[model samples]
Target: MPEPHQLAADADRAAVVTRLDESLADGRLTLAEYEDRSTRAHGARTYGELAELTTDLPRPAAPATPAAPGPSPVARAVYGGAWHGAWGNDLRAAWTSWLVTGVIVTGIWLVSMLGSGDLVYPWPVWVVGPWGVVLLARTLGERRSRGDRQLPA
Candidate 1:
């Protein structure tokens, strides 16, 4: 498990982002305003502050998809929970699917770049998304192999 500080930070980020989403949906904030706020929200320092910001915000739709397999740590971490409730497993499956997809996407991007074409993704997306996939793949695999001992059967 990661340090509590990091988990708290991730939760804070998720909350702040949700607040940004609510602000964008309401006419009280414009796209540009939302963008500016989003930039700041991503840099938020504490869950307390994020809780404050989202106090008046409408509830956001959960990113969890319970019909699937367990959620990867990235899913849990990004979605502001230890596990994504019933959908955690499904989200983990989705992450695995994305990992395979990311490899294909990167391969195509590489081929395109080699042929004097452009990558479908920005350089950072290729780097970050795949790294996340790989990390989550390992994390979820470890969790799954540990069996229902840790998670609900």
Candidate 2:
């Protein structure tokens, strides 16, 4: 698993940008400086990079304790903890359901096709397609909402 500090997400960038905006409004930074730092903050790919953008200003969020830089095998060995953390908190459940539903539906479809000795209309698609579309929409909506919230990194 990647170290916690190794990557920054959209929410992190948004938070730094908010802090930069605050600084600009309060006369701590000029327009050009704010613009430059805002761009850099959005582009930052790690916590350290984001932290640097607001180092001179009052923190907009809790101080990001630099997560341990090394990939700690011990940290990852903690079963559900690292597994959930590996792909953000929500991915494990979504991915697990995707896999399980796919396999079960495929299995049932195969049995139906073989039992009738014919591949007529692929009916399993009815179940799988709608489920997949709904899941995709939910995933995308969650990301969009999270980006909008930008509560913290």
Candidate 3:
């Protein structure tokens, strides 16, 4: 875990603001208080400052959607440590596959054209397109299952 005085990232600031919003909705904080704290949260440069704003409030509930690469409840419960984005690594592997397959397909197409001295059918698309589609479908399904149906990168 980072020291509270360390610089806060956008995600950290966003999380603190979200807590303020929830506190407002629950009547734990007045609109004036929420606005004041939210403004300070946006301007805050360190985790220590953000923590001061929420120290009195209960921790917010976990969002249903899978969060961005960071802490996870299950990881903390089991391993007592923050997550290291192991789940997101799958997408990286998928992208790597796309890059490798695209290069191979393009190379094949170039070789075919050079040998035949004519632009024949772009046969590479046949090899790569369906594979890409399958990967996309699989990624979407997995994300949907996790309640994170946003577009994959």
Candidate 4:
């Protein structure tokens, strides 16, 4: 732990100010006292100086732990996969765009082939294959991060 005699950073001063503001909001300090404490907090050079501003106020409560999340029903209905939530929505959009682009490029390739009367290289594969692979990798990575072994029904 840093000693109170240590120099205070801007963040330290800001924290003290926040405490003072809370104290004022809760009627622990009058407006004049809050202003005085706030000015002193901002001007404080050492941690001890900042600490003196909030010595009487209680500590802020610790944040409660979040509950385990279930799959989002709307996302599930629209996306049709085990994936749900923000990451899942993003992946679904990416995959949808990739699929649409693949279809368009493949159609263009088919038209060119008909006009030339020769089956040349499918250049669209070069465009879409690597993109699809990257998206697949991202999807798998998201699943791994969530500790999911199999896709949901």
> Best by lDDT, which number?
4
For 1-153, candidate 2 gives per-residue lDDT tens digits of 235478988988897898888899999999999999999987889988887787889756576688544324543354212322324555547667877888898898899889999986777688678877876776665555544332222
**Per-prediction TM-score, please?**
0.29, 0.36, 0.40, 0.55
Order by TM-score, highest first: 4, 3, 2, 1
Better of 1 and 4 by TM-score: 4
> Cα deviation in Å at residue 98, candidate 4?
5.2
Quote the lDDT for 71 in model 3.
36
How much lDDT does candidate 2 score? 0.71
Clash count (model 1, backbone only): 9
Candidate 3 colliding pairs: none
lDDT of each: 0.61, 0.71, 0.77, 0.81
TM-score, cand. 3 vs. native: 0.40
lDDT per residue, candidate 1, 1-153, as tens digits?
333344346766775777677677777678987786677677767555455555666666679766745545664558433334343344445566677877777776788787876545446476557678666766665556555555323
Clashing pairs in 2: none
Q: Indicate the worst ten consecutive residues by lDDT in candidate 2.
A: 78-87
Candidate 1 clashing pairs, residues 3+ apart or interchain: 66-87, 68-90, 69-89, 69-90, 70-88, 70-89, 70-90, 71-88, 71-89
Name the top TM-score candidate. Answer: 4
lDDT of 2 at 104: 92
